[model samples]
Target: MAKTQKGDKALHSLFAGATAGAIEAFITYPTEFVKTRSQFGGKKEGPIAIIRETVKTKGFGGLYSGCTALVVGNSVKAGVRFLTYDYFKRKLSDSEGKLSAPRSLLAGLGAGMTEAVIAVTPSETIKTKLIDDAKRPNPQYRGLIHGTVQIVKQEGIAGIYRGLFPVMMRQGANSAVRFTTYATLKQVVQGTARPGQPLPSAITFGIGGIAGLVTVYTTMPLDVVKTRMQSLSARAQYRNSFHCAYRIFTEEGLLKFWAGTTPRLTRLVLSGGIVFTVYENIMKVIGNSGEETS
Candidate 1:
């Protein structure tokens, strides 16, 4: 019975994480596209204005540019993160279900590193290429599969992982901070209520929003560097994460690192709220520890 229950919990964590990622990506991907474009430093308008202009100029599909890879990537990444987080957090938890903040942070760190290596690097590469091509006067590689093939044929498998280092850094930090903040918030909010106690979805959602906002801000500079590093074609200019950071700081102005922050913040806050709400609710249905902390 204990073994059966453990199996069920693991399955629930994986499924709930995947479902939450898909739903959140579907809802927020438009803003994600805008965020990416804005980060490239071409757009001067706010997200709303940018959205309107994109719609006006390129039609509705414009907002969904490069969505296929983003959606799939997010699903895999979030699923992996939550699955590993559940596993680690469970191992770190006591019989009373009291997992300390540091333990939670460790769990998050493992989860982040897992998702970054397993899913983020390649998918993000494909997604970034599609979006970057959209901005070019003469776009390369007709679509996702074609683009991927061209990259492989020209640059080999290494091309698909152009900014692997920074991506790992960005995503690793993103999940660690996000999960730590979220778990700490849940611990404080639930306060001796025990693992099964019901907390309002609203509160959980709000806490998730705060976590997402902080994570984005915390990693925004790396995100910018990652974007620049991935958006390039042919030989790369920035050698590594630190070099990319240095050039962006010294050359593009320190403020350049924050260029697309507005859209990113908007997208992340809402998406994070939605992800946690959905994830927790799904965990409730699955009767697993994913929602226990909340």
Candidate 2:
């Protein structure tokens, strides 16, 4: 049901997606750090409390410890996501210019799983370590390059993907929720708008933010497990994603699994808002340019 999407159109989607992801990561890095640490669940501090402590102990820079990795990883992750999602969605769509929820869900799942296998794991692993290790007075890894290189050297490339399955689970579910919710929200909003007129940017962003919050609430347990698996700590004792999940569920109960819900929600809500908004705007520009050229 989707329109013809190839050549410049697909490229536009990928570029827009990359731009969106980079912007989202940049805007949310600090909160992301807090979210990562919060997932550890050993600390009694809440989000704000943790932020205050980090600033006091490590300065504002502490909040942005994983920024480089966030930006790079998210750029690749989001770009790949939109690119793949659009392709798969077009492939799976019906002839009536409509997409069923299940198909959309599948498209999202495909997008997430693909990104997890490629970009998300390694980048997020580095980001997690940077945030989790920032508290050390003499942190072993210094910055993004040094940290990444060291992780690879010390633990091999496998270390960078330490929490691959959990990451996949979280991201795959996240994409599924995100695309479906955003698509649904967009359709709902457009239904109210004047025919042939676009939805307002504010409305679009609001939809994205709400969709992000939904995804966060739904996938937070996997996110917590992912963070724990990535972080270099003794407390994170587990053999695999299932093992980690079982441990958290059995030992910490269900509530503990959603430990970093607050910061994660905040980051993702804003990230989603920014990602969709920016992507749409960029696509608009690209489309206009392509038409004029044609």
Query: Which candidate number would show the highest lDDT if scored against the true structure?
Result: 2
User: TM-scores across all candidates?
Assistant: 0.91, 0.93
RMSD of 2: 3.4
Residue 26 of model 2 has an lDDT of 88
Off by over 4 Å in 1: 41-49, 192-196, 289-294
In order, how many clashes per candidate? Answer: 0, 0
Task: Mark the regions of model 2 whose C-alpha exceeds 4 Å error after superposition.
Answer: 1-5, 234-236, 288-294
- Give model 2's TM-score versus the native structure: 0.93
Clashes of 2: 0
Ten-residue region with minimum lDDT total, candidate 1:
285-294
Q: Could you give me the TM-score of model 1 versus the true structure? A: 0.91
Residue 36 accuracy (lDDT) in model 2: 81
Error of model 2, residue 257, in angstroms? 0.9
lDDT of 1 by residue, 5-49 (tens): 888777788888888998888888887788777766444567788
Local accuracy of candidate 2 as per-residue lDDT tens digits, 64-88: 9989998999999989998899878
